[model samples]
Target: MKVKCKSKSAFVQPIGCMMLSIISGMGISPLVLAVPRQVSLHSPEQSAQRQPQKIAQASGTDTPQRSQLIQQANALYSQGDFKGAEENLRQFTKKFPEDAFGHFQLGNVLFQQKKSEEAISAYREAIRLKPKYALAYNASGMVYASQSRWEEAITEYKKALEINPNYGEALTNFALAMWQTNKKDEALSSLEKALNIFKTQNRGEKVNQVERILKEIKTADEPGVS
Candidate 1:
């Protein structure tokens, strides 16, 4: 995505304005409400090192046991049993501390539990275990963004993008950070690029979200009568 942003603190525009306006123009529900607070919904990318957690291809007798544990953990996660997932991931990591995937899964669980600092640390460990793990960098960037550390977030996102330029999640998230930091032009370019990429990729609800924001920005840019 090619969301460009400007580096100025000029009044950052609200994205929902345009979205609501567009919906109104379409003769849909004429609801009037304050804009919702923006939150990053994209989960950080999965670390390549941790990719084996769900599907371990290692040649070992313990593989089956490890896989079964991961499956159970996933089931728990899907069932909103975050505590159970956390326990499972913790035990798995203890047994396979050297496994980058284990660290990554633990980080994911910690993040879900709102343990931002711990999650970041776990993601860092995953990164250390596998320097080329693009997902770790992406996940770290997401944590940094949550902390409002735009520069750090940008750095992590860039690292992920470097590993894979087509990392759409990283691209869009980086754009959001840029927008938050008053990089309007850059943000727009990045958002546009993200929109284009998602049009072809099965990005699910993200496509609608980006489009909504883009529309709001466009409306916010319109010259309103004083």
Candidate 2:
């Protein structure tokens, strides 16, 4: 998950590079292109576990048909068929506009295609549908981050953290945006918090990765280190 720091402008490495391993275990395929890692999408298994209840609540009836549609989209996404996934998700959202997950999935697919603006719109739609959608906020922040919109990214990440303080992914992303904005101390603090969360979650690999980044930051901050 570790990538050598290339330049100040590239603070966050490709999302795929950082999260590929984790996503693989969750039955999701990692993006092959080298785009800055933005947001983590729910794995197919996670989506399946949660979607039924969410669909029932939002649609007032969770039909087998709706579940099948979602599964089809998820299958396309897992197979790296972004176009198919997008089409299916678009249909799903149009039919169930209140389903935040559908919008979120659409955003993820658009992002994978490098349609930043469209992706942001989709993420925003998801958030509008579900104001407390922390993952959508995190995903939006990542798009901003990729565009080097550090301040906006920070704001979005903060909103996500407000909704879910222990959101490790958001905390990690927040730290990266903070560092890019030259808030070195704040970035270090956030990374420490993220590290602790990962450790508590028993994500040993992530803990190690964050520790490496933290060490690099501290070392670079030392006098004459550069």
List where candidate 1 sits over 4 angstroms from the true fold: 1-56, 59-62, 202-204, 223-226
Per-candidate TM vs. native? Answer: 0.73, 0.76
**Full-model lDDT for every candidate:** 0.62, 0.67
Cα lDDT of model 2 overall?
A: 0.67
- For model 1, residues 90-199, the per-residue Cα lDDT tens digits are 88778777777767767777766768799889989988877867777777776676555778988998898898776666677777667667788887887788777766
Clashes of each: 26, 1
Task: Give the total clashing residue pairs for model 2.
Answer: 1
* TM-score for candidate 1: 0.73
Q: How well does model 1 score by local distance difference test?
A: 0.62
